[model samples]
Every structure is written in C-alpha cells, then in structure tokens.
Target: MTNVERFLNQVRQSSLGMKRLVVVAPHDEATLLAVEHARKELSIDAVLVGEEEKIVAAAELAGVCLMPYDVVATYGDSAAADCAVRLIAEGKGQVLMKGLIDTSILLKALLKKEYDLRTGRLLSHVALLLPPQGHGYYLLTDAGMNISPSLYDKQQIIENAVDIAHALGNDNPNVALLCAKEKAYDKMPATLDAVELQALNLAGDITGCTVSGPLQLDLAVSAQAAMMKGCKDPVAGNVDIFVAPTIEVGNVFGKALKYMGGYVYAGVVVGAKIPVVLVSRADSEQEKLLSIAMACVCTTSIPMEAGRMMPEMESA
Candidate 1:
C-alpha cells in the first residue's frame, strides 16, 4: 500500500475513542451513508443534528438504523448549524461535519462570537487529490473558501497546508507556490509574497516545509520541466503540496486534475483543534469516508517523536 493508504488504515485502527463529532443535515443521502460507513468501520461517532423527522426518514430509506445513535432536533439549516456549533462549544462534540445545509449557513454560525472555534486568520478549504496517473498526491488549497486572499491571509493558508504536511510525515514538504511565472517581479505582488515566504522558511519562522514559489504548473510537477527551465531548486520537482495564488487558481487546479486527469481526492479543513472532514455533496461516499480517515491520521501526527531525522538542506 502507498503511504496515504497506510495512513488511512492506521487511522482506522487508532481513531477509536478519539472524540464525539456532530454531523449537521443528516437528511442528505450521501452524507448519511458516509457517516454510516465510518461508524461501522472507524472509531468515530457522530450526533446527528437536523430536522428530526426528515433525518430519521432519510436514515431509514438509506438503511441506516438510528436507534443506537442520539439525534438532535433542529428545524432548519441555520438552526442545525447553530445546534452543531453549540454542541462543539459545550464539549459534546469535537468537530462539525457539513451535510444538507448550505456552506454559508455553517460559516455564519462558525463565525459567531460564542462558537469559540474561530481563529483570527483567514478560513480556507483545502483538498487533497491522488490518482492512478499521479505517482503521489498533490494538494489544492483555499478552493471552497477564501475567494480572495491577501498576502497576509496567504501566509496563514500556507501554515494550514504545512500542518497537514507535517502530519503526513513529510518534514520539509516541497511547496510549489503556484503562480503564472517562475521569477519575482515588482509588477506581481504574488511573486513578492512567494519570495517572502521562502525567506521565512529559511529563518525558521516556517518550521515544517521548504517552500518554492512563482512556479507555473508545468515546472512544479514535472521534473523534466524543472530540468528544461534550469531550475535547480529542490522544490522545483517532487513537490508534495501546491499553494495557489488565490482560491480561483486552486479551485480550477483541483477540478481540472480530477475531471480531466482522473484523480481521486479527499479533503479536510485544517487549523481546527482537529482535522475537519469537508467533502462536498458531489463527493463519492468513498471520498467522504477517506477524508475522515485522513483527518484521524493527521491528528496522530501532532506529537513530536524523539530522534526523528529532519530533511537535509541544500545551499542555494
């Protein structure tokens, strides 16, 4: 099995007794099916929050018996979001999974003063794509959230991706900051931000990853392209992560890779106290369940291990 597959298997074994989660909008078929599979297979449990009647009806239709689970009552989408948020705040649940409700409704509740889960930094949605064509997986970030991000917000976004990289056991994650060009120019502020991030990595401000930026897609993923461009940077090839300049770029990259290139993907919202599985309604049940499993493995990577070998550095 590949590293990620191994990680998922390890996650399934270790995620038992981790925490209680809340799944909002249990009325959705795909969402409920994913919950069912995860519950039957993993160590995770969820408190279903939504219209009680609809939730039960959908559960029954989908062959999910809710008798063993606690179902919370909420009248509508916003109410479901609020109830899930309240459950997390009350220490009844560790994370909130989106379901039938609109993403906007849940964001509204998450941003409220009482939720206590809000960080001052920008909220971004990151997706991980792996497929038969690609030898390893690549990341697409800030896709579903953060429509437009300033350089400052991009820094926080990079931190979020780095956290996941660390969890996956990549000490110096090769970060290709996706952009149109390969060099920094005064006219392009994004390139300047990319250069600044590289400096931050060298100064130890960014601890977990080796970042390269101002790279277009070709050079970042293809070592042949890197050689043709005469780009000697370590991150020019073998990049484990892709940090797009904005949400549009990331969103396009993700969908294109999946639809055009036939990739398998699993996504999670990082920077929370724990990883939040944020698969979309269009996602297959396998994708949703794998996302939860990935998050569980990431949770385990938080601890520091003794005598770990850090990635070797190459002088510029």
Candidate 2:
C-alpha cells in the first residue's frame, strides 16, 4: 500500500476518535460522495454545510447516503461557508473542505476574526502527485492559491511545503527552487530569489529542509540531469518540493504531469489551523480517497519534528 493508503488503513483500524471535517458546499455531488466515503470507510466525521435539499439531492444522485452526519442546513454557498467556519471554531471540526462553493467564500470565512484559525501565515495549496511512471512522489505548491507571489511569499511557500513534508514523515525534506534556468542570473528575478532561498537555507533562516535553487525541472527530479548540470548538493535532483516561480508555472507543470503523465493527484491547503483538502473536480473517486488519506497522513504527523516528509512516501 502507499503511505497514504497506509494512513487511511490506520484511520480504519482505530480512529482513536473520529476527527471532524467541516465540508463547505457539501451539497455538491462529488463533494458529498467523497465525504461520505471518508466518514464511513476511513473513520472521519463530517458536518455538511449546504442547502439541505440540494445536499440531499446530490447524495441521491451520487447513490450515497449522507443522513448519518450532521447537516448544518445553510442556504447559498456564502451561508455554507459561514457555517463551516463556525463549525471549525466551535470545536465541532478540526479541518475544513471546499465543495461546489467558490474558494474565496471559504477563505474569507477562514480569515475572519471569529474563526481564530489563522496563524498569521499565508495559506498556500500543495498538491501531491504520484505520477504512475515515477517511483517518487512530488510536491506541487500554490496550485490553488497565491496567483503571483514575491520572494517573501515564496519563502513562506517553502515553509508551508516543508511543514507538509515533515507531516508526511520526512525528517528533512530537500526543496528545490524551480526556475526556467538552472543558475542565478542577476537580471532574472526568479533565479535571484532562488539564490536567496538557497542562502537562507545555508544560513539557517530556513530549517528542517535542504534548500537548493535555480534548478530547472529536470535537475529537480533527475539525478543524471543534476550531474550533467554539474550541480553539487545533497538536494540536487532529489527534492521533495519544487517551489515554482509562479502559480502559472506550477499549475501548468502540474497539469502537464497529470494529463500527459497520468499522475494520481491529491492536495491540501497548508499553513492553516488544520489541513484543508480540495480535490480536483475531474479526479476519480480513488484520487479523492487518496487525497483524504494524504491529509490524514499529514495530520497524524503534527506532533513530529518538522522536515520529515522526504523518503517516507513512495508509490503503491
């Protein structure tokens, strides 16, 4: 089994206590089906927030039963967002989810004062892709958030990925700052920031991970490519997270890997009070189950030391 499946199996064997997940827009068919499976099969507890009739309708369409869980019975996506956030803050749930609702609505609710879930850190989305051909899984960041990030934001972005890597059980994740070019060119801002991130890792400003930078996609994954580039570092060609220069770059590259390479994908919003799962609408039920499993794996690693996500997760 994959590390994710193992985690889900663990969740299956004994929940210790069922963890609560506040699913916003739970009325959506895909969202409801995923939640129901997570609850019944994986030992997760959920509070569904959406229009009551629509939620029930979606469940019926999906051929899944949703009546067992608490339904918040809210109207409209905005109202569902409000209820989901309130559920989290009221200690009714530990995690948040997005459904058919706009991500902005859920994010706005999460960032609100009453929720008290913010850690004063920018929340970024990280996708874990287990591309079928490759043995190593990869971390794709900001695919759902941070449209255009600056150097400072990239630092936080790396921090978020590092945290995720640790949560997934890597002791010290190796991170690569990805750019089109492989070296820091003073004129190219991406390369420059990559160099800066490298410096931070070297100077100990960034901990729990080995940071290397100005690496092209090849150098981030292929050791032969790193050797060909004459790059010398433990992180060369073996990075846990690839920090893309922009969300466009990350999004495009990630989709390329998924569509062209047929990757099994899962994602979670990081730097939040708890892991927030968001699956692709086009993903399969197995993919959605894998996403929830990945979230549970990350959640279980919360008490461990940071930077433990490298090497622990391999393909099924």
Candidate 3:
C-alpha cells in the first residue's frame, strides 16, 4: 500500500531525471519553505519569480538561501506569474508552482495564446489521498476546478486523471462516477451523466481505464455496503478514482477525508504542457512540498503503458 509520504519518497529517489521547478511570486513563508525543501531534499533546481526584495525577505524568514536559485524580478504578482509561464513555455522550466499569486492570475498567464501551454483541453485538479485506514491510496478529481462540468468536460477530466494514474503506475485504474444512487434516474442529472460515462468507457470511446457509474459514496468505497445493498459489479469492491459530480461535492469529499477522516494528500493540476503544482494559500508547508513532489513525478519522466510518452507533456 503506497501512502502519500512513501509515494513522495519514491518520487524523490526515482531514477527519472530532475527538472527545474519555477515558483511564481513566492512571497510567503509557506511557499518559500516548500520550494527550498523541494530543492534540498529532492534535488530539484528552482527558479523564483517575484519582486526580488520581497522574495529575499521571505527566504530569510524561512531560513532558505536564495544563492542557489535563479531569481527573476517582476513588478507584481501577476507579472511574476507571467514571467514563470514564459519560462516554462521556453522549456527552461518543466514544472510550474503556485506561490503567493492568485490562482486566477497564474491560470490566465498559462492560457495565453503565446504561452503554448494550452492544448484545447480543460484543466483539472487531481488529489491523491492516503486515507487514515485504507489499504491503498485513492484519487479525487476536479475538486478545485471546473465548477459544474458538462458530460464532455467530465470525459476530459477523467482522461486527465487516467493519465496521472498511469504515471503513478496504475496501468488500468478503475473509475467510479459518484452519485447519490447506484441506479440512474432521469430526475437526477448526475446519475444520467454517470450512465453515459460508463457506456462511453464500455464502448472504448474512452480508453485506458475501466469506469462504472451511478455509485453512491458507500458503494463506491465499501464492499460490505455494496454487498448489503445487493450491488453486483466488478467495480463495486475496487475503485481507484472517484469522479465527483460537481466541484462542491469533490471539494467537500476531499476535505472530509482530510479534516475528519485524518487523510493527507497532494494535489496538482493537469492538462497543460507541464503539470501545475497548485497548493492553497492556507495549506501547510508540508502539504505544499508534497504537491511539489507530485508535480516533479508527473513532469520529469513518466512513461505511460504500452511504451507511450506522457501525452500531456508531449510537444503540441
């Protein structure tokens, strides 16, 4: 069973080569510590983009030396984000990290036409959770992005997550489209969407994953609950990914696992030329570092199944 910490350790020691991680507007202590930690512990080269004076001050406060990194001076948070994205576009940086800048600012810079990071695909967030007492890890998707995804958007979201799962060595991850009921009802849109998603997977319209749908929370994770409810399906007892019907549901579900169920997690944004390490402003330093580790693994040397390259990082 791979826990979050173990996964991070593996990422740090994996034979795959390292890449430069650029931190945009790292003016806060948490962000500074996270970047420095990734640099010293994981051997990741780092570039810091922000007002240089403030970044220096933050580094001093965090007890991290700025001598080892490249510091790009930008006028504002938005400008810092733009500089970082431009660096990534030029292939100088392989991983982008969110720091003190607002997510909207970072995203706007990433989506700019000149940046060439966007591939006409929607960006989605995937959180890898180590449950307090679970046998293995679980994934939750779109918890921080795509407020109310359409069926097509959901398909892309699932594809992005499947890509991540493959990167993490799950060749054929089981996906569960979560809903309130195990059976589709026309009155409930999520249930209807789930059924369609399942059909698409069954017909090979969606590849590289096995998906089942319209599963309640209990049935998705608990074989005992599924047996008690008389649900009979291969996915009933085993689900690797939980595709929440809405941003609200995904957000609450991940938080419940963290705040109540005592889970630790690392989340990253996919569907760009490089994976985005996005940690909340309120996140702890450890959580932010974990996200950096996750991004490193996604961007450095992920060899997907069948000798395929990482589709998301492939040149457009």
Candidate 4:
C-alpha cells in the first residue's frame, strides 16, 4: 500500500471538481490554512461558516483567500455547526469538517434525526499515522470517539476502518486486534473480544479484510518481533489497521507517536453519510490538510464485498 505522502499526491492529482467541504466555525488560523491548502492542492470547493468578519480576518492571517468560498454568516459555533450541517443535508456540501468549535457541538447537529446523515452505523474515529521512518501509513481506530465500545461496536469500528483502507487503495486490509499479550486469558475481556473478532473473520462473519488477534503492539507492526517470538502470523508484520482495546489506548498511543515518536497523522470520523474531518485544534497545519485529503479520497467509491474469506458472513 502507498504511504501517506503518496496517497495524498494521488488525491491531489485526481480530476477537478473534487468533493465540496463545509467547515463549521471556520475562524481558526490552522483550519483556514489547511482548507486553503486543500483548495489550492486538491481543487476542493469550500463553504466556510462562522462569524463572517472573524472568518475573513483569520483567513487573511493565514494568507488564505476566501473569495472562492461561500462564507456563511453565523452568530456562534452552535449556529455555525447547525448551518453547515443543514447545507450538507441540502446537498450543498459533500463533506463536513469541524473548525474552531467543540466537536460535541458539531456532532450534536450531525446526529439530529432530521439531518438524515445516519446510516444506522456507529460513528468511530480513525487516525492515519505517518511514521517518520515508515514506508506506509498505520491506522488507529476509535481513538477520538467511543470511550469503551462493546463487541458489536468494535465490529462496526472494524468495518469503518476497512472502508478507509479501501479508500487508501488497499482492497483487503490486514487488521490486528491489539492486546497486551499474544494469548487470550478468560479474565481479560479485550483478549476474549479479540478471540471472538478473529473467529468472526475466520467464520466469515466479517468480510473484506484479514483479521488476527491477541497480538501485542510490537508483534503487530514488527516482523522482527514476530520472528523473535517464533510466530508466523500473516497479519503480524503487515497489519494495516490497529484496533485499540479502548479509546484511552488508541488516544494515548497516537499522541505518543506524534509527540514522542515523531509521527504526523490525519484523523476523521467515519460511518456517517459522508466522511467527517475532525482534527484536533492542536494538530499542525500539515496534519489538518492531510485530514482533508483523506476525507476527500474516501468520497471516491465504496468497496464491495465479493465471496468473503469467511463465506458465512454472507448469511450473517
């Protein structure tokens, strides 16, 4: 699979008339700069919603021209979020991004039943980590949403991450159910959950990806770690997605990678009618721009499941 830089280049080089992005409360410097990069690099049309004066000033600070965008005047973040989501529901925008507003406020507007964005699937966060020394990107899921997802929630999370993998040009992604050890103990619920998820994939209850479970983080990403342990797991070294047992795990690990391990990342909310770019306020401009590119790439096409590896998922 291609790395983050390569994948972003592919998105940049795609045909014009890219997906339209609607940003709520777009008055922040980083957000404005990132969207400006998207506008110039990917040809994404933008709809900026917020206090028009503030948005214009911030865009100027970021050296971004707002002339090409539809800047909607709104009173506050709450109103901006509502207005942006309404525009999306009206087909004026193809993607929604959070900007200079609380994510909860944005999500509240998005989840309103009247908006019709829900597909009856759980919304989860997937972050694409671009390790400074790696050849490809690593995906970490449910990091920003779902505090402690149930087994069923994990299923949907995996499905969402798989969709992202497909968007990144990997038709069949390898998933690693990350755990503390390489074995399941009855007392460890995460280990047990891993076992069941792996079984589901093996039995075809999950489709479109290869799943392996109860693997420690090292083994999941390092071929040498698997070799040192005398393990011959197919997904051990080449896992595309790392399924964190809990939100804390994913969140802390991703931050550690960025702050301590020198990795850049892009995060988005999935399982909506369209992909949602939701980067942190502290994220660098590059991270925010990459998130926009990631969301746009995901708008391409859906991955269809053929005869599943686990044929029984067809009936399940």
Candidate number with greatest TM-score: 3
Q: What is the alpha-carbon lDDT of model 1 when measured against the actual structure? A: 0.72
TM-score of 3: 0.91
Model 4 ranges with Cα > 4 A deviation: 1-4, 13-16, 301-316
Cα error, candidate 2, residue 195 (Å): 0.7
Candidate 2, superposed: residue stretches over 4 Å from native: 1-17, 300-316
Give the alpha carbon lDDT tens digit for every residue of 1-316 in model 2: 6645654565455442557778887666788888887776677788888888888899889997766888878888777888888887787887788788777667777767666766645677788887575255778887767777878788878888888787666779989888888777987899999999899889999889999888888878889988987877788868888888877888888888878977777778766566777765798887787677666655554331222111111111
Off by over 4 Å in 3: 300-316
What would you estimate as the lDDT of candidate 2? Answer: 0.75
Write model 4 residue lDDT over 139-253, tens digit each, in one string.
Answer: 8997778787888889988998998888777889999999997888987899999999999999998888999999999999889989999989899988999999988899898
How accurate locally is residue 187 in candidate 4, as Cα lDDT from 0 to 100?
79
Task: Arrange candidates by TM-score, descending.
Answer: 3, 4, 2, 1
TM-score of 1: 0.87
Q: What C-alpha lDDT do the candidate models reach, one value each?
A: 0.72, 0.75, 0.81, 0.82
Candidate 1, 6: how far from true, in Å? 3.8
TM-score of 2: 0.89
For model 4, where is the 10-residue window of minimal lDDT? 307-316
Comparing 1 and 4 by lDDT, which wins? 4
